[model samples]
Target: MGTKFGSVIHRADRGTFRAKYTYHGEVITKTFKDRLSAEAWLNGERSRVEADKAGITKWTSPTDRKRQEAAVKRRRTLFCDYVMDEFAPTWLNYATDGSELASGSKRKHREYLQHLTHSFFWKYPLTSITTEDINRWLADLDNFGGATPRKKTFQLLKAVYSKAVAEGAVAKSPVTMKAPAVPKSRQAQIPPATAEELQTIYANMPSTTRISVWLGAILDLRIGEVVSLQVQDWNPKTQTLRVCHSADVNGQLKSTKTATSNTTQPVPPQLGKLIDKACEDKRPTDFIVTCADGTHITPNRLRDHFNEAKTKARRPDLHFHTLRATSITAAVATGASLKDTMQWGRHADAATSIERYQRASGTERMREIANGIEDTLMGHEPTREELEAEIQKTKERLADLERQLDALK
Candidate 1:
């Protein structure tokens, strides 16, 4: 009773069965201990050959299948390789909005990528990384210190995976963690420099660089914008200072931080005169503020001088940006509307001007408010001088209203 199975022969002399299959002009043979085992082996080989013919499988031979798998493994992208080789190179070229990132922003992304390389799963294949791996990496970021850095690193990592997903490298990202909260230290507002503090700092600054303080505290220009001011960017006739460019961390000239940051600010008479003096005997392309060698001053150098001046003024807490805060706060104190203050500060929105720059009312403003309340309660009569001032203000208001009505007509 010889077993009858395709390509399976009962070798009675050897007490075994031989199973053979031909695939792509190659033969595969295996010996089984019994007829049942041989039949099963032959059936599997036949099914595999059918699958190959139907284009369901790429290889029929086991060695060829192993080779195909090895080739696929070579094509897998690792996390570190994708970041360093592909993403980092083009990150600064365009932002999410398709605009070139500011140099400072580009620099920060480079730093974030550097930090990501330190993660434990940097060597893992992009598709193989799991949510548990991301969470673990975030836990390790705690040792790197500060919530801000951790948050930024996590965001960069998410962006990397997002790029991978967009390119069809993976079905989805594994970065499932919510964005880290802002640190409490950053949430607390630092007070703007008071009038007395501003004056003291101004007096302490060297005469040559005193205009930098005015630029910050009066025009509300950022440190980068201050250093990037050229003679052509100022208009003496209109008393307007245009902010079109700013210095990056490396002191390289780049566009302003945001589109709204490129604004023309109306300069006060005092600051305008100071600027005129700074621009004396200089070309239209010369920097408004320069070092002793007549070259544009770097932000670091300006900060060094500013730190010395603030220290001497007994306001070590006053950062360079505190001067900008002082300017916006002063504008608001002068009864400037929210929209006006937003334009004056060159902020993108009213909320940023109010929440980030404006500070609580100072002692003088508080006293003025209290005095007005007291006068109203006591029914204080207006003196002759006060009455004259009120009449003048009323006349001006009526004239302005008439002009607006005429324009409407």
Candidate 2:
């Protein structure tokens, strides 16, 4: 007699059990020595079938498993140790010379790696880590910051594991889990400073940054674009400024943020004359906005200068970007169309100009609506011709009503 468990059969005469299951449209049979062993093997095969049906992964063939097993036997290095010696150098080279990532971005990724280095679980063998372990690590990063940082850290870890997989250090990556969504902040209206307030700040600023403030507030130039302005970019005859280049935080010259940003915009005559005066005795190669020694003014220097002037003017919240937003808001308030505002502000989209930069304070909007209702209630007297036409229409309506009343009587 033979004990049977679905397709698994234990043959008493042979003292062996045959376990069978369907794999890749073919029947696979394995022999075991005991009935319990046959049932256990059969259950595992059925589980693999269900997992494949659910689209998790295809069943691993015995040959493939043996090959992976051989590969795992050769992996002697732990993840932390391997990353420190081999992966770190490879990643640095890829991040710096072989990739398009910026220097600032590379620095941030390295900082996140330090967080991983502090975790004890990351010191384990790379091949031993499961997806559950990766998910738990992501949960641990929730204490670091908001969803954005958690997501970024997870992405960095994924990149590291992918590199490991490519280098044959591991069979596959265990970081297919998704991170939390980044929450969006509500946009707030930022009111522009008045002309008197701007003048006060401008007067108090140093000579090096005075022109910078003027260009930013009047022309609505980004802080990067303002600092990158050279003598040649300005044309006194046409009164147009060609915004083709900008400087990074490190004072490295690069193209504008977008193609639309590389435009020739008109400058007001007042600001044009100020630029002309500053350009006096300076060559085309010389930067129009620079330090006393004629070097390209870094973003840090510009921010420091602006902050001092802002504190003096009593507008502690004012920033260089605020000046740009203020200028765009003023232009829109004074009957500028959305298209025109977008062009002048160098916005790639109109929604950014209308929604983000435009300033209409809550109280100010309420006041305008209240004033409109009051003006409607306090009526104006009609002209004589308008009164006569209204009286004639009223008489005709009354006559029709009287005729209807007589017919009813």
Locate the minimum summed-lDDT window of 10 residues in model 1: 355-364
Q: For model 2, how does the per-residue alpha-carbon lDDT over 1-409 read when each residue is reduced to its tens digit?
A: 2223247676779988888765676767788988678788777777777887899978786667778786775375677887777667656434434644445555766776776676556678777878887767767654455666667667667777877888777878888777656554322334577777788888987786788887888888888888888899999999999898877888788767655678998988889999998898999978888887767798789888888888878888787888887787677667677667777878755766665433522355568778788779986577899899999989999998999999999
**What C-alpha lDDT, on a 0 to 100 scale, does residue 279 get in candidate 2?**
91
TM values, all candidates: 0.63, 0.52
On lDDT, the candidate that comes out on top is 1
| C-alpha-based local distance difference test score of model 1 | 0.79
Question: What's the count of clashing pairs in each model shown?
Answer: 0, 0
